[model samples]
Target: DQVMIISESDVKSLLTLQDAIHLTEKAYSELNAAQSMIFPAVREEIKEYQGIFGIKSSYLIAKKYIGLKAGGFWLGNAAKGKMNHQSTMMLFDAESGEPLCALSANYLTAVRTGAAGAVAAKSLARKDSKIIGIIGAGTQARTQLEGLLATFPVEQVLIYGKTEGKEELLAKEIIEKGYSAAICPSPQELAGQSDIIVTTTPSYAPVLHTSWVKDGAHINAIGSDTRGKRELVIDRKPDKMVCDLWVQSSIMGEFQHGITREELYAEIGEIVNNNKKGRENEGEITLFDSTGLSVQDLEVASFVYEAFKSKFV
Candidate 1:
């Protein structure tokens, strides 16, 4: 098995935020058509290490490939001059079950997660929505904004971060990029001012309240991907809610223990394939629970493999 090694820098150069968004949509569309299968993720917390670790895997029938992405997030890594999130991807031939390639998956994770939120915003949010509120200042925050900016004609932006300096820097970066942006005092202020909100904080409890949100607001709940973690406080069920996959979202996504099957509007795949409705009314508040999918990683890896083969092989 000739394992083609694709490095981190290669991934960064090959997959732009726009490329991520487009390919992720294709993955979801194929999944909706019953052409893909995503296995359960194995995630765990290690108190001694002060980090989280997991393995995500998927199979794509249309592409004739299978793969797994394994990595972890270390809270102490920043002090070591490293990133918090790291991942590695391995691809296999679906028929022969032979290893085909290996890839760096951190950028894949960020972009796919960001694209997942952006896809939700495009499908569910108001078509003319302009203002966006960001609730995290981490690396994923930038990609989430980039994905949204690519999809919508944004006019203004609001952001809330724990550290003032970091939040200000993010605001400055956006402003320097020629966007109208600011750092809000709190999640409440950001929620109130934004037409669409993207929450990427790793808070265990709810960080934003529905009371602060306005009518017709759309929310991409991206932070809480595990049970007992949440970024939005949904005292009652949201008017409309969607997820990448109902099975995973109900168990480990932002919805976690809350939200019943009756409350879920549809999976993102269903909406993308037009098999179900997205947002039915302009006045309805919509929420998307993005539990990053394994198929997304596999999809991107396969896409890059082709590109790499054509260029380097």
Candidate 2:
């Protein structure tokens, strides 16, 4: 077995935003078709090592681009029960059962998550959106910025974070990437200036208020992947709402409190495939409630696996 361990740099060299978006859409479509099994039994808590360990795992096995991809993760206390950590894994193979590859999922997850948000922004955000407001200055925030810049012509970006040093550091890095980025004094200031706002924090309470959002703005809430991790107010509703998966979003995504499964206007995949219109009106406030789907991981992994195979063999 020739195990090819591709680094993040190697993956970046081989795949572009267009490639990632296409693969993500294809993965979501396949997942939507097989909705029955895609909705797995989510276990929030599990027993491990004769002790209680909190585990949030969702099983998703899908067929995409002539290969099978399985998505799962385990989150619990690590480091002698002093720290909290999560690990995600992906398994990929062709239909013939030939094991293709496995990857360290942190970067893969970040890229796919960012790509999915980009897809949502492409469909739901206004065409004239030039200013971006970002909350959280971490690894996920960087990818979100990269993905958004790849799809939209953002002119300025305002970032807010709890850590002042980290915020300034990220702002400098983002500015170095050729965008006008700065650390904002408050989330309100960030929200007021940006036409497109993306919140990538793990805040339990709302970090963004509805009153601060302007008309026709699009918001991508990327941090609220697990239950109780939301960044927007539950009482605040947007004019249009899109999600990666309705079933998953309602249960674990940011939409868990504000909207039900049936209330979602459209899935991002549907919008990407042109089955539904995104940003129909100019004054519409659109929200892309991202729960982070497994299909995205599967698609991106499959793409990388195929690229590695084609070049190596």
The candidate that wins on lDDT is: 1
Whole-model lDDT for model 1 versus the true structure? Answer: 0.86
After superposition, the stretches of candidate 1 with alpha carbons farther than 4 Å from their true spots are: none
TM-score of 1: 0.96
Report lDDT (CA) for all predictions: 0.86, 0.71
What shift in Å separates residue 133 of candidate 2 from its native position after superposition? 0.2
Score every model by TM-score: 0.96, 0.83
In model 1, which residue pairs have backbone atoms overlapping below 3 Å?
Answer: none
Cα misplacement distance, residue 50 of candidate 1 (Å): 1.3
What's model 2's overall lDDT?
0.71
Tens digits of per-residue lDDT, candidate 1, 1-313, equal 4689998888887877777788889999999998999887999987797788889899999789999999877778867878788889999999999999999888878988888888888889998889999998887898899888888889888989886577888999999889999888888888988889999877777888877788899999888777667787785456888888888888778767668888888999888999988888888888998988899898888988888888888
